[model samples]
Target chain A: PQNNKSVHCHHPCKNIHVFQKVAGIVIGKSDVKSFPDRKNIGVDRFTFSFTVKDSPDFFINVTAWGNDGYINLLSGSFSVGDCVVIENPLVATKDPEKGERFCPTTPSHYRLLVTEAHSQVYLCADIDTMDRLLPLIHLPVKDSRDFYSLGDIVANGQKLDGTVINVLAAVKSIGEPKQFTTSDRRKGQRLEVKLFDDSVSSLPLVCWDREAIQLVQTLIPKETVLFIADVKISFDSFRNSMAATVNSKTIITVNPDTREASLLFSYAKEASESGALDQDEKPEDAKTIINIVMFLDSITDVYTVTQLKEKAQENPEAFFGITYSFISKLDLDSSVSKVIRTRCTRCKLQVMEETQSCPNQLCPGRDQAFSASTGFDLLVDFTDHTGTVHGCALRSPMAEQALGCTTNEFTMLTDDQRTAMKWKFLLERCKIYVKILPSTKMRTGIRGVILACTRADPGEVKQHMSALLQRL
Target chain B: RQTQETLTKKPAVENSLRILTAVIDGMRHWSQFKDKVPYLFEIFATLDSAVTVGRHGAKNFLMRDGKEVVQCVFYENEQELPRLIRGQVHRCVGNYDRSTDVLVCVSVRPGLPSELRNAQEAVKACDAEMRVLVKSISEV
Candidate 1:
């Protein structure tokens, strides 16, 4: 009954329900600005620019004005390179006097305005369109742009006059957000964050007002790449280093879609991987194993070899399960020969038989009595009709399960006996569940190492086999 | 006296047998044969020469049905397969092989019935065509 109503648009004002929606990818953003309203109360303005999807040459500028709540929502939701749709928008012509003076440069004459009550902005999830426009969205800086590094600013110790410079860096650390009273008795928040680039030196970036509080609450240092635009450079005499002061017109982008941001991300990833940074300074992916372990504990979603490969390529940090039929033991003789090795229980480092102690000084076994444990490295080939993969199951628990014997008993067996046992237990024609841990060497690559292996329940396998047989 | 007793009971047994025969006829007509048993039949316009391997006592053959070319493997445990002659239609039943894209035939019988003669003609029209719809055995 509600759908039967006829929609009508009024003549003078742009009707809220009849306006055409604009679809494009965000390419640039301006800094947040506050202006006085009719009652002299301050309101925030958030503006961004985007290129039309069908016509990339045409750029549209969007201004969300007069409401701090709507401005904050837009600021938190929209980012560059995100394809978005703004519905029921109010299109207005740009004033000639304000031409070229706007912060985010746009090519089109028309501008769009959206408010919380009259408009809606939806971030598009079209991955293909985003991929196509990814490399095309260039920053609006000049071709001969001379950006200064943190090292250059610190060495110069003096500000360059009438020059606006940009710095592309990753957030290295963040200080606690503190509230401070301004000269006019207005309460404001301040936060100091450390930023690093490909250079050897780093800069201390000070943010004030709402931005400081937002950074302290949302940003994860060393993981978030930041592009600081139009910030005034100054020398901190007390620390004797260069610092950048964030102001009302300074635009700060977190993980923006730009070549420089990607480069900084790769640098941060490399630093985290090479152990050049501290343990606590590692990137978010370093904690993926713990997240995956927690995720796998609650759910059981078995993936095929092909599905596992595709999923691993998408997100290599997540653990996946593969149901595979046992093929054959690959390099059985070589694997069994080096199966048993003495390792420190605490450090898991291979301890030499002569030392009779753990080599790692930090390990508890170094000071205590020698606590040795046996470990195994078993590699086998498995297949699931669709594809074949080499599964490497390491350590004692997996070895005990695969060999059907305890590690102590296995160590006491002769080499020939171990080989025989491997042949006997590994060749069964049954379905098995294998947990795959992605290799760190190839990020977003398909190859994974088998972390654990266990035979599936016979009853469940029978049901699966019957279902498969019916399909066949 | 025993013959006389059997004769007296024969009519009742015959009546029950007639009802059983009617039920079997209804089931045969209503139920699809392919759905009951996993079987496939294909007419081949041409078949490759069968090669017998001594190691596994297996014979491998390649044939083209209407849709695609399929490889057929028969083991010693199954009945021996006659030599594949070109331009002759044969019926095959087996599980599908996903790995090698082959049909592992358990039973290969030569010649199509009169009802399937049109299928044989269709195969002849399209040279080296696949006529079978067997699912892959490795899928199981």
Candidate 2:
């Protein structure tokens, strides 16, 4: 049995067996370059180099269209004397005469294609040649200072890529005429961007039309790391390097759809150090329950978000908390367990809990029930303000029965008891007002109300609260 | 009147004219009363801006500032009605309680009669269109 120990991995590589069958490693690096094809193919031979542990140094030849526009992208003038970590590169065969070739392992002539390369171009030593680059491993870039003098692309004779950049600009409303012109003249158009940062000087950044334009438009603000790919920056008409414009063919994209927080987990390190037996075993069910507890605890602890605006600002974290709780609860009960009690697929009648055979006579779904949990019966019980209920949750005909002469008639009742549990529980802890909606699935003449809870600003708890409330 | 007669037509030109007429009617009512009275046009538009144009025209009233808005009906649709408009940049013509089905008149705007005719036509077309979508569905 082949194990991952055989391959020397510098970066996180999971499911090594899955990659074994793959011909070439699907790389996430953006070391694309376009140069004029002086050797004859009428296209520039683009070279992209990346590295992997135990695997031979790999390079990919990219054919970039060389127009007067790609002149900036073609000029690879960065001084490369820095140590770098090239991820998951595979050695691919290449020929000076041929456009494409198959992957061969017998010391064939090939170019090195790097996957997800992380590098600082001007580090302590010159590590470009693959032979001399074996021993030294580059460290992670920590701050803005670490990128200083990391000579790669000289934007106006200076390093302009590693700036702590922040931009506040509206979606540029470009007319159809200008939109048409980019496809006609440059093969890519530009957006007039107004950029800003805490730095003393700001300038227009003429971004190549490929990736950067999309990045500027789609990227949600407050992203920790910006993975920019295939973009060439020129001083814009405003002469501000910060005021950038994206041209066509210049691609600006990132590794992940990075809107939310990205928490990297090193499970390999955990499993290796903690013990493989623990890793191999299914996780304990309490893990999810504990997460739910933690989420509820976090929301209760938040005292600062008193106003709706403040609460709305904290809504993301609040929703994240709710999500973690709900997901944890969901994880506790597998789908198989949920279907322990079945219902009829057609008439929607309750069947046996273990087997989905309905006991109802003359019912279409009788003796052909699906699952107990599959039955659309709602169970609601009135709970005190503390969210602890007084009576047990009902099922069947009893669950469908309405309330009889209660002091809290105004308290809303929902169709689903679990949904009510979540709402009432949250409402009890906070000032959120919720009204349960009537369900068509529910039997007629049944009125349900779990309890009364005050209303909070909808905008504040809106994200965390289930959309079910809206439907109700 | 000519525009109102062509409300059910699918031509973009007619549609735009009908929409414009509805807006003009809503604007007229919007300009009339000083006490911020809620008009019938505003009430219908509050329920569904794109529903029956007659209803929408009736519902299509305005608040003080000019951006278009209608009352959010949570009770009828079983949806959560937005209580407070997040930003105060725009004014609301009416406030609706999803549970109580109560509509409170917040502001007023007088509109032109020509716009009312346009709104009426647009609404009639919308109702007919809904009937078509509903007619196509076969019950299981």
Model 2 off-target regions past 4 Å?
A1-28, A31-131, A143-281, A288-306, A309-472, B1-140
lDDT of the candidates, in the order given? 0.51, 0.28
Tens digits of per-residue lDDT for model 2, A1-472: 0121323332223222333222222122223455566766776544432222222233222222234433233324221222333323342335444433212111224333322231111222333443443331221112212221101222221123223322221121222211222312434334443221212112234443333343355533222223222233322111112123333222222222222102211322332346542332343223222222222233321111112213333332212111101000111112322312346543445555565454545443332323344321333332210111212122222111121211122123333433433332321212311112233444321222221123233233333223322322
Q: What i-RMS does each candidate reach, in Å?
A: 23.8, 21.8
Interface RMSD of 2: 21.8
Which residue runs of candidate 1 sit more than 4 Å off their true CA positions?
Answer: A1-19, A25-36, A39-60, A66-83, A92-102, A107-110, A115-120, A123-146, A159-162, A209-220, A223-225, A247-472, B1-140
lDDT, candidate 1, A118-158, per-residue tens = 77888866787557555444443322134566555544433
Q: What is each model's TM-score for chain A?
A: 0.41, 0.23
| DockQ for each model | 0.01, 0.02
Which prediction has the highest TM-score against the true structure? 1
What's the distance in Å from true for residue A43, model 2? 13
